[model samples]
Target: MEEADSCRRAALEAVADVEPPRLHEYLDSILDRASMVPAVLTLESAAAMRTEGRVLEDADEPHRDGESEPDRNRTQAVSSDRDPARITTHAAGVQLIYEGLRLTRSLAHDEPWTATDAEASDADLGILAADILVARGFYLLARTDAADKAVRTVQSFGRDQTRREDLESGAETSAGTAVGIDGGDPASTDANLERDVLELAVRTGAVAVGETPSPRLHAVVAEFAADVGTSFPPVADCLTDLHARARELSLEDSTTDRATSATDP
Candidate 1:
């Protein structure tokens, strides 16, 4: 346990500085952990390849496209330029998170699978590894988006001569201040953005996609629509109604299943 804690700390420190001596210590400790041996080795190998400036063919290559040479070359260059250490870290972090989730799920189901059991299941390990890779990909994309947003926000703020008092007073503000270039109409634009994001997320290999509407979300949306003087019902209401129907359908399915089982020999 102490070794594991030390490894975690070292790993955290290694993220910022690849040359950190603690990195080897962390990797070694991870190697010591019987259950996490495979994951640890995978991470260590990736890190070593990174240190040696060796590119992973599978990771560095993007899907081919019948595009212009400049565009294709640029895409390949960008993929190659991505830091392997960062990729390894992201992958390891995602694997750790998923393993924790798996353990929790097993406990919740009262079919507690031990570390040994986890080690035995090659299929389960592969599935977890794939999930980790996909999760890391999503995280990298999100991080890039956040960095881009931050840069744009800073540039906009620097250019704008808007005052805090003016914003508070609802005074006429620059379009840049009121609606950011990236910010589009919430009703149509947000829906489209959500769809695009969901599609991209799935394409990047998200294992599950779900949206849960809060109970009071309907009221909030309705109030907003009323304030806008729009005749359309709130999106939250539609989601909530769909959820209710789904629950009803699930109950009916359960009843049917029970009846069928009862009638069976």
Candidate 2:
């Protein structure tokens, strides 16, 4: 969908200014492998459905009397000004933050380094890209309602990773696929990263529409994300599933609101 395309473009554009062509290319490649589906679509659909019937103009720029038509049109197509594409920036922020965390996890797991100068350079640039992505993501959500959730997600990631390293360092046997979120196993820690990030997506999306996700909604997202079993999908299927469930829950919530409103004096 439109939300995926829009959010991906926004993410790529956000990193367009990274110095050195090779580093920029590396960052682009990382993003290319990312499924810009879950977080962005959740945010877009929530905001769109919640604010139905209202026009949300692209707010990236104030219209100028003398601005060129093409410029205005281009801005509107990618900017988070309206529904379907509403909250593109916020969605992009959640996506980038997740990607950055994912990258950091990879670096921690692999420690990719070599004797060759070029390989070492690439490794260094990878770290740089991760930092830039997280920083940029933070900048986007710095003023949004999801800011604290985003921060907590990152903090949780750090804690999980740290615990995983400590556990691995002392463990006598490989935990394998049997590991779980409570077992202090490496795989489960990794799953927790995805779980927390996905939860952030759901919460961020809901709050973007002025609604807090109910506890049941959080439980649903967490369970789905944790059960992905290690590697995350590089397509929209997983996120699509989440969006469908979230939408259903949101509809239930909306119905309750309407019923309560109708009964109020």
Candidate 1, residues 1-265, lDDT tens digits: the string is 2322333343343333322454334333432342322123223222222212223344345556676778766555445434444434433343343233333233322433344775546335434443443333234434432223223322332233233234434453543555443243333322322222222222211111112222232333333323322121233333344334434443454465578879999
Worst 10 residues of 2 by lDDT: 47-56
Question: CA lDDT, every prediction?
Answer: 0.34, 0.72
- Candidate 1 least-lDDT 10 residues: 201-210
Model 2: residue 210 alpha-carbon error in angstroms:
1.7
What's the TM-score of each model vs. the native?
0.23, 0.78
- Off-target runs (Cα >4 Å) in candidate 2 are 44-86, 114-117, 171-181, 262-265
The TM-score leader among the candidates is: 2
Error of 1 at 56 (Å): 9.2
Model 2 per-residue lDDT at 155: 94
